[model samples]
Target: MQLGKAVRLERIMNRNNGRTIIVPLDHGVTVGPIYGLVDLRETVNQVAEGGANAMLMHKGIPRCSHRRHGRDIGLIIHLSASTSLSPHPNAKTLVGSVTDAIKLGADAVSVHINLGDETESRMLADLGAICSEANEWGMPVLAMMYARGPKIENEYDPDVVAHCARVGVELGADIVKVNYTGDPKSFVRVVEGCCVPVVIAGGPKLENELDLVRMVHDSVQAGGAGLSVGRNIFQHPNPVKIVAALHKVVHEDWDIDAAMELL
Candidate 1:
């Protein structure tokens, strides 16, 4: 671990708690500016004000969302993307580079890898290439690893999730993000499999806010470093409320019951 990378990762994850709440705004590239993201700056401001550790976005967005007034938030540039319209949307292809992220003043860079996808080999190869580039610059890399594709029966299976997370660590990711295995006990295997920090992803919008908070709480209990949840936090009518609640759960050691009060 280089000093440069360590220092940069501190900006993304709280050094004391070793946890982070990263809101991904890169959804626009994949899903077309759905819901809350229509105003990326405002959404970023709201979450930043609520104490989000970082915000992840594609290259063009950092410049637009970087503002002068709100609390400073760390930025992670997403390097891969594929639109919903694509025939194989799960096959994420690199749309930017580590150099591009650094030029955009990103504290970290992330790439998506769908393990069981038809193009897994390409995505994995690209991940290795980008990681090498990131190493040269001493930039931290977060791998968005998922068990998605034809063969996967239940992506949430703990074994499958753990394998996805391990792939990130094996490939040199500083941090790994994968889906939670419904409960804390099951997700523990995921954290144990990867020596690096592991964060859980918010798959889709949940029906209730309590469910979101509970899921985050359980993941934390299972030793998750934090969350890279997007739509669940951003799409809520009160984005700040949700991010604030999540901040408490991830950083302040608040219990599920206590955390739910924020919402």
Candidate 2:
């Protein structure tokens, strides 16, 4: 790996713990500007101040939301989008290029791929293209791979999630984001199958903060790298506290009881 890219990846994943707490703030493209994101600059600052390893956002966010002063966090530009209201919501399309992301001072670029979607081929092609382009610039690529489609009986099936993670590695992703398969035993398959680092998605916003904290604990126990969470952390009334709680789980390997105390 190029020293520049290696150094940037270190910003996202802690060198000591080999894990990360990436708060994704790019939902506006798919779900409109929801709570916790109306004021992008403030939201970014809140998570960074809480010791989040990185923030994944769309191209425009860096220009509009990056704080002039505060804790500096790694920035990853998400290149794919598909609205929930779309007829084929799982069919993600690329809206930004790696070169565009690099110009925006991105440390890395990410792409979303729905493995069983009707447009699965298109998304895979986009992943390959982005990886190729990102490699030339020595930028890391993070693939958010999911099994979502009419044919998929269970997106969180352990076998299916393993496939999702493996695809990210097969396609040259430096890191892979996937859904947790409920427990450590099942989720371990995903972590083992992929050679690259595997992080769990926060999934839907849970009913309580403890549920989110427990999920992070479970994923870490399963040997997963960490989390790429969004609403559960950012949309919470106490965003900074929530991220601090999760940081304990990911970096310190705290059990639920210890992590929950941070909340």
TM values, all candidates:
0.98, 0.98
Q: Give the TM-score of candidate 1.
A: 0.98
Q: Could you give candidate 1's per-residue lDDT for residues 146-250 as a string of tens digits?
A: 988999999999999999999899988999999999999989989998999999999889999889888888899889999999999889888888898889888
Off by over 4 Å in 1: none
Q: Write the per-residue lDDT of candidate 2 for residues 172-262, one digit (tens) a residue.
A: 9999999989999999888989988899999888999888888889989989999999999888988889998888888887889987776
Clashes per candidate, residues 3 or more apart or on different chains: 0, 0
Worst 10 residues of 2 by lDDT: 253-262
lDDT of each: 0.92, 0.91
Which window of 10 residues has the lowest lDDT sum in candidate 1? 61-70
